[model samples]
Target chain A: MPLGDETIVLSRRQAEIGFAILAGLAGFVILFGAMEHDTGWSRSGPEAGYFPFRLGMLLMAASGVILLRVLLQRGPSEPFLSWGAAKKLLAFLLPLIGFVLLIGPVGLYLAGAAYLFVAIGLIGRVPWLKSGLIAVLVPVFLFIAFEYAFKAPLPKGPLGPLFGLI
Target chain B: MVENFTQLMQGFAVSLSAYHIALMMAGVMFGLVVGVMPGLGAPNGVSLLLPLTFTMEPVSAVILLTSMYWGALIGGSTTSILFNIPGEPSSIATTFDGYPMAKRGEATKALTFAFLSSGFGALFGVVVVTLLASSITKFALLFSPVEYFLVFVLAFASFIAFGAGSPLKTIVSILIGLALASVGMDTISGSMRLTYDIPELIRGISFLVVVIGLFGLGELLETMQNPYAAKAVTTRLDWAEVFRSAMIWPRHYASLLRSAIIGCWMGIAPGGPTAASFMSYGIGKRMSRNGANFGKGEPDGLVSAETADQAAGSAAMLPMLALGLPSSATAAVLLGGLLIWGITPGPTLFREKPEFVWGLISSMYLANVVAVIMALATVPLFARMMQVPFSITGPIIAMICVIGAWTVAGAPFDLWLLMVFGVVGFVMKALDYPLAPLVLGMVLGDRMEDAFRQSMLLSGGKFSAFLGSPLAVVISSLIALCILVAVMGAVRRRA
Candidate 1:
């Protein structure tokens, strides 16, 4: 039941307030964008902005209510995320972010392999040999399955030209 | 009725090919894996497989998808019984009694009962769909733009009335979904609405990418906060125990029937399988003769929950097909798939594509049978797979999600979008905001807008256009009633 090492990084109340404010900002942006066009009922019918304009208002109103309720209510401030949990999340997420960044330059196959190797070996603390095996095998399997069987081409980056996969 | 039967016979001809049967088996197998894993689910599983079905015939594609759904429903119960972990949200109720039964060395019996009752409930649900398909389609054909818009309102209202969340938060979630859906080109006025001058925004945010980020990567991130160390109870399948469990089915016939009916009603009303299973379990505890021993490894409790879960899962298809209203997130994803295939879901679908409609229905019958057999045969395999550490499985799943998002439109921008939605999904779950309404809104937003505009055009731009017909009046009143009930309930709880 212990989710983390028990040092609270953010409280539930703070997170709620922050999110509500962000939503309000998003609502304002939507409204601002919506007003670029005619937000009215023309002779033809309701204009395009008419629907989105009302939607923006409704979003702002809903978030405002949420913000007000959270502010007015008095309660215990539970931990939203602990330091340990945050560290764990970052460990998983950072590599994923790297994988996404790597996808554009190295293609899906190589980036995927590199991601699997690091994630499994370093973060997961698995044995290097097994991690290397999985890193190599999975992408190969995906390559054959996607390229040959399904014929849905995935991004291969430099590897595509080198292997004549493109 | 005779005509319906004849069409169904023709549907059998379309779906009964050897190739289609193989697809069912493969889909079910994949579904079981997805269902057994705690993070992966039917919605994620279906979305991941959606791109693969792009080349397939609609009937074959749907059969594959529906078959995977049946397999996931059945697979979800396996983890609940063996590991006391519900793989799918709908199967959470099964753990109340299923885990206890497994602990008492009746794992085989518990699993058999769960699978058999699931099959029974699914069969019951399909029978209901078969009988009511024509009538529902007929009723839907009478709808005008007013009625269609009202139906959308009714769907949202029912979510608020029945949702186990704060109404304000649910509204915010729904509004966000609608706002996101309106981002691309405006179909009605032939102008851009909310693109914000971004090139990627012109195509709009793909719901498939949203789904991949939200349910797929979002679940992985959440699961990482507290990883599951699965301690599975080892049990080999015994034929004698299975036969014994099958023989006792008649004793719990009333519970099974009652739960199936509850499930069907909930499915059609948009309460969905998670709610249906819990409702059936609670009601079964009150009504059963074994009520005294309800939660302590009671067979009737397991039966009630599993039956209702599968029943609702199958029965939810009716609304999605007949009215273009998906009652669950997975069904919403399927609705998205239908649109991708250029087949508009509604009453006209029945008239124009009898083979497609009937083929899907008939395949349900075949898929559930295949699901039961496959679920039983592969229990040990999945149970072993569950023993793999989350660290390894987690990365693999994340990789799969990345690939899935990329495949949607092969846009790198979607990968970024996927990341943003993942964060949103995790935060929303932590805050107890319902995700299903958001998904429902995203799927139906454009259509709802069109219905509203068309209604305005029809009624000469009057706000009173919604109540122009008696059917519209009834729907509007129902929406009002749902909101009233929710308000009164909230007030009473506060007081």
Candidate 2:
């Protein structure tokens, strides 16, 4: 439950470098747009982009300082993400992305049921019958609750008519 | 004052009807389910329900939504006690002590105390709203762009005051949020700033989608991935112990009162419940005779977090009611609901439609009382959920997140944004950056920008006019001091 060493895999320095670079790049992008929109004061005073422009520059400088601090620090460091935690994160998150992608073509209801069955029966290693039942029932419940009770229709794919009773 | 009280009593007459009570109960129950679920929180719950409000009366709609808000805050602590996973960000502090109590086989005691303290806090918040109703109305009616802008600045400054992260990180996070907020077409000039020629990007990033991803999916990804993180399920349901704790809670009156006041101030100031929770708990731990006893299953710590969270959640309505300003994400969604219902929330709301405003204020009290009773009755049912396998629970959460994101705009693009922010949330968490400020920034960012531009236009481009108002001067000075202190502290630590 705690974010302890067990979850830490990357060295502190590596994580710091990665975050700093990302932030610094984002800052540069922001600054670029801000400058293009006229970041300086105008005839009326500060322009639309004026405040954001300064904010972007500050982000870059602050991130640079952060990178420096991490580099210079001599104290002992902890790993950012442990190996086991990394595997778990990827295993859980990657399949979730796949499920989300399938929603467009497969429909939310169909994709959700399939995702549930596979995630529960296969990845979770639960009994097939129970997982199948849950996979079927939850979508049905959501259909009734959302489509009928609330009258807020969810995304319907090709197979949407299969559960139109609700 | 007497007239407002009489009107408030009439408001209560409206709220106490059987039909309204049933709605309140349903709202509370739904809110609890949303809160007990790991992937949903107050903002997500309210936004998801916004669609259903279209057909209902404005009073019933506000009552339902606000009761759900109350239920969500109370339900948030349940998971914190049982699973060491905060159902909402504000309950993160509760996990510090509540989980320890659960581990010690006092799950019912912790739940009882948390629910009761939360109820008390809600009452305190309602009392404040009742007493300050006229004054708040006056303030709202009189406030110019200058006062309102200062209030927004105070909201922005709060992130720094409340954030424990490095000032640079906070600033960077806020800037990113502000930049993201600017992505949609500019409301003022109708000029697109960062849409990148994408049709879907025209609406900019929906705060609802971004939040569902950041808090809901991001949290699911974290604990669901790590099997080792799961603890042995604790399922003690002793009514006697709970009753005893409830009976004894009033003895800790000092902490209860102090935390209530702290929560009220934070809620009013736009500091949000998370900050209030942390601040209240910190103060409780410091002032308690059992200071070192905290984080070791201490009751007072749980009380502090619970009380402050609810107090702040309830009191957060003040700004929304008085000024149409939302202090938190949930409040923002509630404001959105108000707009949808064609009920403009401002000073005139009091004079023009006392029934709507007073009805809402009265229902808040009833909702808190009802939420506590509902929460107590259903604690066993919710506790059973914590024992359910994550395999089943995890997918359900993902489905809910996807459904919530998809339904908000009924746009598939929101699902994509949800996915993107989920990863963004993961990375931010992996790097120890706080997510609350980012959320606050996103919600307050556009408003702050608009306020600034308006102030600029009003001043006719004179930046000094920002300093012309005493209120603005005070708030701006506060922000300056916050940055200066943060910088000085960093330098001192380095030296």
lDDT of 2 by residue, B33-98 (tens): 888876667777776676667789999999999999999999988888888878788899999999
Worst 10 residues of 2 chain B by lDDT: B224-233
Q: Highest TM-score among the candidates is held by which one?
A: 1
Worst 10 residues of 1 chain A by lDDT: A157-166
Judging by DockQ against the true structure, name the best candidate: 1
Cα lDDT tens digits, model 2, A1-166, are: 6665366668867887898889989888878766657666666555767766876788899788888878888878876678777777776777678888888898888888988988888888889999999999999899888888888888778877766643
Q: Chain A TM-score per candidate?
A: 0.93, 0.86
**Candidate 1 docking category?**
high
Please identify model 2 stretches exceeding 4 Å from their true place: A1-9, A34-55, A161-166, B17-19, B51-58, B82-85, B95-106, B227-236, B240-245, B289-292, B295-298, B336-349
Clashing pairs in 2: A7-A82, A8-A81, A8-A82, A9-A81, A9-A82, A10-A81
| DockQ (Cα-based) for each candidate | 0.82, 0.51
